[model samples]
Target: MKTILTAATLIATLAVSGAAVAQDFVQSGTTPTLPQREGQAIYNAVCSGCHMADGRGAEGAGAYPPLANSDFVESPDAVIAWVLNGYRAMPPLGSIMDDEQVAEVVNYVRHNLGNSYEGSSTAADVQAMRE
Candidate 1:
């Protein structure tokens, strides 16, 4: 009787552990894919001149700011707005890029240099901000 009870308890513990592991696997597997892999090209064409390839801006003595360690990239909505509307010295990109392209570039910046914050920006978000 004692052995049977111990075996049942052990089995229950194992089952709980297995379920926890499965949940972790599912969560990690659900990360969304980035929209663009040609992030380098997009950056070069649009952003590199100002922000630089390393995401460090070149305005003046610590004036332009660097996106490499920026907190702005962590928030999808904030980055989207800044990209579309422009910041202090940054020009608005909305005129140049459509919603889809904006999203792709946003994803590129976020994943490639934005500390891998793992959030995706949508076209709807951009349009709404414009309105």
Candidate 2:
């Protein structure tokens, strides 16, 4: 009985902590901002929540499509637009991130996360998409 109680307490504690971490991603009344400016940093801080740290994605409350070896990520424009405009269950994060940050994340997701796409996206490209 004591062991069961301890397990229940651990579960409850983990649930609360997880919810708190998830809240960091929510916009709330104002737009939430991420301090990381680099591509890999931004992806780890923001995208990794749903996409997972390994970029394998997750499925629980919702379905988060994987970024690994994905054809969808080949188009930098599409990823940039999706990040800015949001897609389906994904929230639009343009308000929180600058153009450079967006480009960095695009490049990071494209080149890393089990992807080996060539070329890079410039901040100017991200700015153009914003317009």
Candidate 3:
């Protein structure tokens, strides 16, 4: 019973901390409205830590590849696969995010962050890639 209670307490604490971080993210307006721009939300929350707000990656312990004007970011299908399986350095986001979330973030990165690609990826596309 004591162990169960402790586990519950830990879960609740994690929930509250996660909420706090989300609240802070909302207040910052770095990600914007999730309903409207889930991609930006994921990017700001997950990618911005290493990729930077502008998507210009840096070299520290490992190379954080630049997304700005990077031809490597062209294909949405390829991008989805990379996010799900990870290429190198970047950990696979599929473990943490759903297909829709992956699509949104991929779309966000494609069009924004100094990119001008005329293509976009839908949630359906991400779902297909996941399968």
The digit string of per-residue lDDT tens for model 3 on 7-93 reads: 788677557645644653543344333433488878877776567668897554467888878888998888899889988777877
- Per TM-score, the best of the predicted structures is 2
**What is the Cα-based lDDT of residue 40 in candidate 1?**
60
Off by over 4 Å in 2: 1-33
The best candidate in terms of lDDT: 2
lDDT string, candidate 2, 16-130, tens digits: 6457446654544553556677888788768877787788976655798999889989998999999999999999989899898899999999999889998899999999999
lDDT at 47, model 1:
71
In what order do the candidates fall by lDDT, top score first?
2, 3, 1
- Give the 10-residue window scoring lowest on summed lDDT in candidate 2: 24-33
TM-score of each: 0.63, 0.78, 0.70
Q: How many residue pairs in model 2 have overlapping backbones? A: 0
Better of 2 and 3 by TM-score: 2
lDDT of 1 by residue, 1-131 (tens): 99888778867754764464444323223333322235565565567555766786654323656678677688888888888899877788776666776777787788876568776777787788888
Clashing pairs in 1: none
